[model samples]
Target: MANQLGIYGEQQAAQYFLSRGGIILGRNVRYNCGEIDLIVQMGGEVVFVEVKTRSSWDFGAAESVTPRKFTRMKRAAAAWLEGQPYRSVRFDVWVYVVDKGAVEHYEGIDGGAS
Candidate 1:
């Protein structure tokens, strides 16, 4: 059930991104130690995106990506870029909140030094 909700959230985010002129590059791309939720290109920038989905803010907001998570994301981004054909890259986070059947997006949260 949680996984399904996550997928739904990611789908919603993807749609939102596309509508905003973002181009999807990859989804659920995995490396040996980590995974990237989505890879997108917008305004000629390669964006490594991490999607966080939450039912509510009881624990915290969806943008709350821990340092460990950022580390893993960075490692995955490195692995992804090693085989990619891009010269520039950036890290972005998409926070999805599922509220009363509505999906909200908070895009481009800084992951720090990734």
Candidate 2:
């Protein structure tokens, strides 16, 4: 159930990005460090998305992406880049609320230098 919700959320998020003029660079890309749920290029920036989905927020879905997770995400993004050049990079959280059928985007999320 959770996996299905995640998939749906990713799809929704992808569509959301597409509608807003962002180009989809990758999806579900994985590495030894971690997985990048979505990669988008908007203007001169590459945006790395961490997707979190939940049937409800009782478990605090927005708070689930931990500092350790950010470390892994950064590593995975670097691996994915592989010398690809971008003017800048940003980390974002795309939160999907299943029961509400809503999406929340948190841009420029940080875990320090990780």
Candidate 3:
């Protein structure tokens, strides 16, 4: 059930980005450090996205992204960029509320240096 919800949330988030003129570069990118839910390019910048989903906001879905998780995300993003051409990169988070069918995007999420 949790996996299903996560997949659904990712799908919704992908569509949301596409509608807003973002190009999907990759999905479910995994590395020894961690996993990136999605990679997108918009306005000449590459964005590594983390998607968190919940049935309700009672527990604050986005708040689940702790500092440790952020560290892992940054490492994962770095791994993703290792072989790619240099470009501006940033981190983002997409919080999806399943019950509300809504998504909230937070851009330029900082996790210090990768």
For candidate 1, what is the TM-score? 0.82
Q: For each candidate, what TM-score against the reference?
A: 0.82, 0.92, 0.92
Candidate 3, residues 1-114, lDDT tens digits: the string is: 999999999999899899999999999999988989999988789988899889887857677777798889988988889889848998898989988877788888775222
Local distance difference test, candidate 3: 0.86
lDDT of each: 0.75, 0.87, 0.86
Give lDDT tens digits, candidate 1, residues 48-110: 877777786563444367677878888988888886778777777766667754454544545
Please name the candidate that would achieve the greatest lDDT relative to the true structure.
Answer: 2
At residue 18, give the lDDT of candidate 3.
Answer: 91
Model 3 weakest 10-residue run by lDDT:
105-114
TM-score for candidate 2, please give it: 0.92
Model 1, stretches more than 4 Å misplaced?
A: 61-64, 100-114
Candidate rank order under lDDT: 2, 3, 1
Clashes of each: 0, 0, 0
lDDT of 2 by residue, 3-100 (tens): 89889889988988899999999999999888899999988899999888888766566687889888899999999988797769999998888888
